[model samples]
Target: MLGRRHLLGTTAGAIATTSLLDRTRAWAQQQPFQPEPGATLRFLRWSRFLEAEDRATTENIRAFSEATGVPVRIDSVWQDDVLPQLSVAAGIGNGPDLAWTLHSTPHLFADKVLDLTDVADYIGGKYGGWYPLIEQYGKRDGRWIGISNLVIGVLPVYRVSAAREAGFDSFPTDSDGFLRLCAGLKRIGKPAGFAFGRAPSDGNSFCHWLLWSQGGRLVDENNAVALNSPETLRAVEYARELASHFIPGTIAWNDASNNSAFLAGQVSLTNNAVSIYGKARADGMAMADDIAYANWPVGPVGVPTELHLVYPFIGFRYSRYPNATKALLTFMLEGPQYERVLQSSAGYVSQALHAYDDSPVWRSDPHITVFRDVAARGRPLSYAGALGTQAATAFSEGIVADMFAEAIGGQVSPREAVARAERRALRIYRS
Candidate 1:
């Protein structure tokens, strides 16, 4: 049963009222291979992740069925709107046999999930490679609960030709220079100089790096909240300043929104996932002469900029077929399935070790090379402590979004927003 609070908070409440199990059971039983004569394998994943166009994730599953002679079942669920409901389902032991989610999710389902350390070890030793970034995030208290097959990061993408025309030799080297560059572009009438997206998550993600760049810590080793520090305020102020030059429709932008603006030549430069590069190329957005990539700019901390990555979190509590679950994950990591997922989608990079070698995915593409370079120096946001997801959600949906709004709205001073956010953040930490 969905809690009243859960009902009031999200659309998941509505899904809870529907009958999900009967449909799932029937679906699972209908698949080609039954690992056990009486058992079936069901996969709960983001529908968008296994899109009709994203043939790799699907094909890999199909190949798994063929190779292992075990039938695979898929249940596509949207990550953002439906994951909470799925979490509820998992807690009650009704979740899918295999799950796909962010690195932070397994903690929420920790007890209900299998510790994948042994499985990861078994697979990595026998199968061959694993994504370095995914492998790192899969650990909790030094145990692996999931294996992320996809390791994706964001980079600052720019138009070298347009940047040069704006009287810049290259993209600015630091956050201040980047701000000045935006201001310069506005002075010359580019209208949109920078893109810090307005979605709750995007706002939070961009600010994390911004704060880090300015030497701001959201939390310290003592597990105390640190958003109120002066350095963090300055970082907020800088983002506020840059927000002023965003494309007219930026506030309405979600993750994919900026990509369209960039492809249409409405913005000069912005940070984005490498996958967008594939979209631009597909749309014929002028490759040879227009696009380029760079490390997202450094800030006051002189820190290397990094984009937040989402890793796959698999659990065991809901899986009736543990051996099959292990088998599927093993297949994802060490087999041809890994390479297939990389090439299955445009700009989808694999997380497998040394997978980039001799692969047309990287070798033939110059734009991708830029991202590969950035990944080498990237850092995960400080995982303050115990409640990684809650802390992350608060920072993103609350502090960052609120400060960014105040900055863009020009209502409260950025400093005021920062101070207010600090107080609120402290509450989150203390709670």
Candidate 2:
């Protein structure tokens, strides 16, 4: 029952005889670690991930199933639900072999996830090396707790036509210019929304950008409570100013809100994944032509800083088939499967591995090419600090996002918001 499933597959004879599967299997065998193909792989994926951009991964799942004779069940839930379900599974010590987890999960649940150091090292060595943020998200302490597959490379999705309308022929590349850009957009009734509220995809990712770009950090080198610095106060004040210019209801937006705002012609700019573009292209929406992307404005600190949306693949410690799980992940990351997935997602998914950096998908579109550098330029929320239980807890509770919301909502001063956030950060760090 262990390793016999592939051989006992109903279509084993036919699938086994295919040249691609045969060669892939032989490649699997040559590896120092090979797991017996399991009967089934129960997977829980983020529902947001299954959108049109998810075609490559969705397709490869079928292909992997046929290639390995392993039946895979993929349960798609929203990004918010993924964490709760994963927490329950980890708590009860029983769940899918692999669950879609967020950036800090590998560190937060280090004890509950299967170690994939060997697999990570193998893949990293073969692929160009893993990027910095991948190391922070997937490797906790000294072990690799999960396999990071993609960075939801987020950047400003703006209306090129709107920029021109605002008297700018090109997107601004610095903070001062960005400030003016948003103000101009607001004057034109095309106020940009940055979701100072708790937008999982937009606000969550951008908060770190605002902070880091302004030379502020959640924690210092010692991973202590460092959220109340002067730079952070400036970031909060900047957020407040930006909020005044954002479309109304930004404080309450979720991941989908900004996408809706942009598609509806309500926003001039906002940070997001490529899903908006993918959906527009799919429907041949007229707004698609006006849409364009730009990297973040350089902050006082230096390089293009951002909080990359990192989604990881976690194998539960309760799994009966880690080897099979490893095989599936490895196969998925391999050139043939991964490239298809990236293409299917329409550049919404950027690989953590540098090896795939040359993907042609980036070149296919004039607007999307900026994303090729987004992943490389981004970092996790706990920038300059380790991603662990403390930071994960803080981020999950939306402490940072709420701080901006409160300040922007005019419910609290920027200083007051930073102070409140500081206290919360201390508790989480010391927890």
Taken over the whole model, the C-alpha lDDT of each candidate is 0.63, 0.80
Provide the lowest-lDDT 10-residue window in model 1: 16-25
Best by TM-score: 2
TM-score, structure 2 vs. true:
0.90
lDDT of 2 by residue, 80-143 (tens): 7888888888899888888877778767678988898878888888889889778877887788
lDDT, candidate 1, 1-431, per-residue tens: 98988768667634532323333344345433335544568777776742533565665566566545578888776667446866677767886788877546666666778777866776566555554555555667788876766656666777777677767888777888888777766666664433344553344456566767787766776667767778877777777778776666565567776666677777767666765576767667565346777777787666575645666658566677876776666666644556556655435443445444445566656767655543355554543344365555564455655665666666677778777777777777677
Model 1 collision count = 4
C-alpha RMSD values across all candidates: 10.7, 6.0
Q: How far out, in Å, is residue 196 in model 1?
A: 4.5
Residue-level error in angstroms, candidate 2, position 67: 3.7
